[model samples]
Each structure stands twice: as structure tokens, then as C-alpha cells.
Target: MSVETMTLQEMKFYTGTNPRPEDYEAYWELALVEVASSKTTMEIVPSNLQFSGVQCSELIFSGTDGARIHAKYLRPVTKGKVPVVFLFHGYSGNSGDWCEKLAWIQQGFAVVAMDCRGQAGMSEDKGGVKGTTYSGHIVRGLLDCPNKLLFRQIFLDTAMLVKTVAELTEIDSYRMSVCGGSQGGALALVCAALSPAIKRAVVQYPFLSDYKRIWDLDCRGSAYEELNYFFRSFDPRHEKEEEFFSRLGYIDIQFLMPRVQADILWGIGLRDEACPASSQFAAYNRLCAHKKMVIYPDFGHEVLPGFMDEGMLFLSGVKDS
Candidate 1:
């Protein structure tokens, strides 16, 4: 962890450069309405991937725009309305293998690992945006109306999944939670904000926070490299910089933090250049619910030691039993 990027004191008060749009609350409220209006139906099929004590299945559901979304659902065979956890993946990544998620199942948790739309997964993305879908999802609907932003639909998809999971007779809606790293972490926060049923969230080095801060820090590589690409390819002169960033405010997770009702357990790596410590803090500080942050001073974007164990403890409301 380099003190050169940001001091501990500075990170505590960093309000971030990405200004929240004035209509931020109304925008999300309307977006939620749109998601609610879309009739979502879910289908679950037994999967070949088997675990000793878990039942694995392919969970498919319709998202906003009627795009078919996919997730891997794993539950303990001996279950009676057990707690469930929604697992999101990293940027450009899929839901991951069932074997990797057996730990949670062993802890008596039902896990629904989702593959984000159009990512490296079975999910379908109905692309109808008017702009360049060349590099990343951030700029997918930049040139069109704010409603067309890919994340708007993605965020809605997360909310829709939560709603579907909450309504499941096999799940204890009051005990539902979400967990993920990087882009998945961002979606975890988004899901918690959009779904009041989510009881807890375990987010690690979440992406999609304070876009202008990422630009100012010149730390726009890896998952956020699309920001630089969008600038160079679309607005070379930086003339539409304000408009672009402001439009990006629609999907910025920092602005969505206030809407989160779930208890949050945030993990951050001080040495993370990908998501940046300041950007992570920007969203963490806005959280008004019961929250705790675990800081790994020497870590980067990779996994933090004992994070899964710690996360399970947090979500289970237990102390390493």
C-alpha cells in the first residue's frame, strides 16, 4: 500500500468528483417502476454439477427488456426455507464454478450466482443502443437517452433477481443477502439498494464508483480502461466531458448508497489501483445503515485473506463458529 496515492485521513473525507445528478432519486424510483412493470418469470432446471450435500440447478429469469438472465442456484438438500445469498461476478466475468461456491452451501446457505447480461456467461443481452458498444458497458448507451444505459438495465436485472429470490417459497426472504468482488461488488451494492429485502451485503473493492475520480487519478485501466477508450474514441476533444460524466451519474453506485437498507460489510485494499481506495471510500461513506469496513493495507484488487470466511460470518451474523 502506497501512501502516495491517498493518505488514510484523505480517504476518510473524500467526497469524490463525480457529482450526483439532481434527479438521482427520482431517476431510480422510475427505473424501479419500469422493472416492476416488466413481467418477470423464472425457470429452474436441475444441473449436472453436483455437490455432496447441495442441489445445483440452472436458474433462468427474464430481466428488463425481456432479456433472459442466467444464474447457478445451489441449495442444501436438507433445507426448510433456508437463507440465500446472491453472488455476482467480476467485470467481464461469469458467475464462476459451483465447486468454488460449495463453501457457502456447506454453511447452509442457498447461493444464486448470476452471470451478468452479455458477459462471459449464458445470459442474453438485447442490444439496441444508439452508440458505440465497442469497448465496454459504461459507454454502451452514452449517446442515447439515459434510460438506455446498459447498467440501468443491469441494475434492474439485479433487482429483479432479488425480487424473484425473495418470492421463492424455499427461501427466507428476511435472511437474503448479496456478495461479490469488483464489478460483482458494485452489483451487490446495487441489489441491496434496489431490493429492500436484502438483509446484508459483502462487497470487496467495488467497481463503478466516482467515475470522475477514476479519470482524475489516471487509474483507468483493467476493468475501467473503457473510460479512457470512450474518451479517446468518442469525445477526443473533451468537449462533452461534463455531459458524459453527468450522464454516467445515472449508474454511479455512490449516489445509490443512500437507498441501501441492508447492513454492509465492505472490504477494501489500500493498494488497489483498479478500483482505487478513494473511489471505494466514496461509496462506503455514503452508506447510512449498519456497516463495517475491513481494510487490507498491503493488498490490491485480488482476494483479501480470509475474506470469504469473514464474509460468511458477517452474513450469517455469527462469529466464526
Candidate 2:
């Protein structure tokens, strides 16, 4: 079946909610403009990883000062520049865990999933970037120095994964895409906007955008909890607040949303308290290229109700896949 475009009103009706005030949309637009104007430095280098043949193989990428980021790549039997999908993991999840979710043998796409720094429960995998976190890692020190946010390094690590995958002999450099759920979802949006190599994006239950709204709502997960703590501890007044959020503007979905030129498929749950529907819509509405959002009213946080068919259909049209 061909992908169908749905209007924002239809989305609200189907999902059973009214449109938020226009001011919310304005906030997203303003933040995005600043993010587009700011410059971020990214560096990529080759490294190694270990994966089990069934679904995973280890790969690594180097960040600033040779900090290594770990990754797992799953390749189909087909050879010669196959379409590629770079998968990013959510908060506290690892690369090995996403191998099954992103495996592409069935769809003829090459999949590479990367582990974010500092997450636990990893097996004897080598060369993965070590993440640093302690009690209250997420919100710890966020209010004072947004520049030192963990996501900054995570974004850099994700970019390095893309660059490494592009160099692999069996993957197509030009036809690559990035995808993930929640944290991964946010990263996918950033990669599509920042990297010229990305041609498609699949974001599911995305987190990290509409930061102020999310902070007010009090969502679950470290991403939100961290912000809550940061605000409680560090007090930013006027311009300081803007500078803190402005640094975040570099990675915020709204800021990155407009720069992304690829086709985008977004999955959202109306009842999703974790990421919230409004925040997800804020990002989807600002997308400049062809885009579609699949809303599941009865579902929250998980993609369901024809999501399987939709994913297949969306990826099928990606010329290289």
C-alpha cells in the first residue's frame, strides 16, 4: 500500500486531542532558527566492535581525543553497496539490544546499531565508548552548563558511527538513513539534519525536544529527569537561560527539524506520557521535506496499529533499499 498523508487536524481527531496554542509552535520555530545558526564540531575515526553472527557484530568509532564509541552492525547476505540504516539506541539501552529490531536481511537493508556512552549491561564487547554518569546522571549539572550535556557527546558518537558505516565495503554511502525510538528517535532526526549522507529518517516515540514542555509535564526516563534536576539546582536568569537552552538548541529536534531534507516517517502515540504528543507534533510540523506521522490513539510509547506495514512501505520507496 502507498503511504498516505494525513493532516494535522485529522491527526488530532484521530488521536483525540485539540491543537495546542500557536505559541507552542512559535517556540519550536525560534529555537530551531538558533540551532541552525550555531556551529558544532564533529570528528569521526575508525574503530572495532564485536557482534554475534546471528544478529550483531562489534564495531567502534572514535570521537574527540580518540574516545571510542561501540557499535554493532548486521548485514544481509546480499553484497555490494546495499542501502544502509544506522540505528541509535534509547536511554540506557545498548547496541547489541537493537540488533533484532533493526536487522535488515528480510528487507534488504544493511543495519548498524550503536551503543551510547555510559549505559550498563553490556557483554564482553570491546572498543565501545565508555559513558560517564553517577547518581542523577541525567539532570546532574544540566542547568548550569548545557554545553557539557551528555547528549552532545552522544550526538558526536552517532555521527562517527555513520561515517564508519559509510566506509564499510558492503554498505552504500549515499543511500543511508538513521532511525530509533525515543532517544534514538531524537538522534535520527539530528543525523538527518546534520549529515548530507542521510536520505531518510524513521523516528519512533522521540524524546528530547520541546524541553520546557517536557520538563513541566514531568515525564519518565533519565532524559527528562535530568532536566528536572538541572533546573532545580542551577538557576538561569534571562540571557543565561537562553544560553543554556541555546546550546541545547544545537541538538533539539525543532532546530534540527527544518534542516533535514530527507523523507521522514514519524510514529507517535496520543497517550504517550513519556515523550508527550505535543512535543512530537512540534517536531513533525516543522519538517521541510516530505513527511508523514502515524498516530495510534490506543497506543502509548509503542508503535502499533499497522506500524509494521507502514515501516515496510516507507522503507520500500527509499530508492536504494
Candidate 3:
């Protein structure tokens, strides 16, 4: 079922064209320390979206730079502590409807679905770095200081979510996992890497890895259209090509993969154009922890039916990766 531009053999070996910045580790370590030390005011306002056997609440807290981050927290009506799974949505999308998340209650799971900053969600994007934003977040903090990069802050937000959820008395932090597809997939990896609290990750057709490979493969039009827009609008001559990619390297998931302690349950559509299989492999090949890939040869970046159920099983200990 493999229909990739690059043969499955080649894709497995592909390590990516995005260079890892020398200070990448130090930068993230410092950033994590900074966020951990910051006092974030937390509040869980009970949501009116009620359902049987499920209690829904909006978990809002201050992220780095005081951005108001929000997540829909769903806890099943159970006796003792339940396993938790942090859910991240696709780019420009919100934390999905409450009804969809309630399905996790079948496994007695506690779920947290985050709305990324400044997109189509209730989260706030406080970076406000006046720069060349191609109406997309990848380029939002590009022209400003490297530390202001949007994904950097988004990654921080994920770790913060894990930190926030672990404090709840109704959760077993040890059985936690992170799950998503496309942009959500990339974020799942980022969260697992930053917070080893996550034991499993189900990533499908993840975006935001191997940026240079995507550029060279010409797979930059869909989710990555901003890269083209940035080059045409600012670096028309490709003059700062290396400079920009190097900066992006800071947030590239391949660089962060080695730090991921979670056992991976990665799903890839070999025919995916929005997030090419080769680019995804570049990060997949670098993972240090145990991983199992679920390749969908005939599928694209669109929905892979039943993947949701599969992810839930993996997260709930019903299925082993």
C-alpha cells in the first residue's frame, strides 16, 4: 500500500534537509526553565456543554508572555484516577466539539484538547512581533527575534498543558499520551519531547518537520504556503535562505525527536502532499524511543477513518504499539 514519491525504502532513510541549530537544545532548555518558573494563574471554568457520564470544563491559563491559552478538558464520570490524553488539533482549527471528545469516556479517560494560540480558537497569540506574517503562524515571528518564533511558544504551551493537567487529583499522569494528525501530529511530537510525562504518541501526517526537504520537494503549497510567500515577499532573491531555515531549525521536530521519551504510534499516508511522507520520515528516523509506524498507502492528508478509534485504544492500554 505504499505510493510515495520516494520509495518506502528511501523515505525510511531520509533524515531531512532542515539543519539543527547548534543552540537548539540550550534554547529549549532555557525556555522550559523560564516557563516552569513563571507563575501561571490557572482556572477551570465549568462549561455548559454537558453530557452524560462526562464533565466538561474550559481550562484556561497564562502561557509564556501571559498569552491566555485555552483547552477543553473532559473527564469521565469514574471512581478513581483515570488515564489522560492531551489532544491537539490541526492548524487553524479549534479543539473540536465537545461531543466528539466525549467518546473518550468509554475508556474512562480524561481528555484535554488545546486551541493553539491566535488561530481559529479561543487561545490568545500575544507574541505581537511585528513582522512578515504570510497570514500564517510559521512566519509570524520570523522577522523578529528568533526567540519570538510562534511555534516555540506553541510548543511551550503544550508542555504547560501537561504540567497543568498533572496537578489535577483525578488523573494518573503515568498513563498519559498525546494524539493528533497534520499540524496536530507535529504538536503531539513536540509535547512528548518537551514533557516526558507522555508515554505514547499517535501522530498522523505531521506537519512542520524537514522544512528544507519540503521546499526542495516542492511540497510547500498547502500547509506550508507561507514559506513560498515569505520568500517571494521578503527574500525574493533567496538571499537569506540559509538564515531563515536556520532560524526555523529551532522549532523543527526532527531536532526535538531525540528527546522524546514516548513510545510512538506514527501514522503516515504515503501519498500525502500537504505533509509529504519523506519530510515526515526525516523526523521519524531520528526518534530515539521505541516507535511503530502505521502507513496508509492509499490515503492522503485527509481523514483516515477508524484512526481515531485506533488512537483511543492505544492511549487506553487496549492496544499496544
Report every candidate's CA lDDT: 0.88, 0.61, 0.86
Give the better candidate number (1 or 3) by lDDT: 1
Residue lDDT tens for model 1, 1-321: 442367989889877789778898899999999877877699999998787878899999989778888999999898489999999998888888889988888788999999888778888878732222334898789999989998999999999998887778999888999999999999999999999989899999999999998898888777788888899999999999999999999999999999899988888899988898999999988998989898898998898999878889988889521
- What does candidate 2's lDDT look like per residue over 1-321, in tens digits? 111133446534332122233343454355344444433332333324324332345565565335556666666655466887887777776665543744365677777777666664232222333453432434433555544555555555555566667767677788898778888888888777656578888778887776655654556454566554555557533445544555555446665577788888888877777777776776777788888787776677765677646665576563322
**How does candidate 2 fare on TM-score?**
0.73
Q: Write the per-residue lDDT of candidate 3 for residues 1-321, one digit (tens) a residue.
A: 332468889888888888788888899999889768867577999998889888999999878678888899999887899999889998888888998887777778898999898777788778553222234788868898889888889999998888878888899988888999888999999999999889999989999998888888786676799999999999999999999999999988888999999999888888888888998999999999999888888888988878767877887788988
Provide the clashing-pair count of each candidate structure: 0, 12, 0
lDDT of 1 at 250: 95
In model 3, the runs with Cα more than 4 Å from the true position are 1-4, 127-135
In lDDT terms, how accurate is model 2?
0.61
Which scores greater on TM-score, model 1 or model 2?
1
Best by lDDT: 1
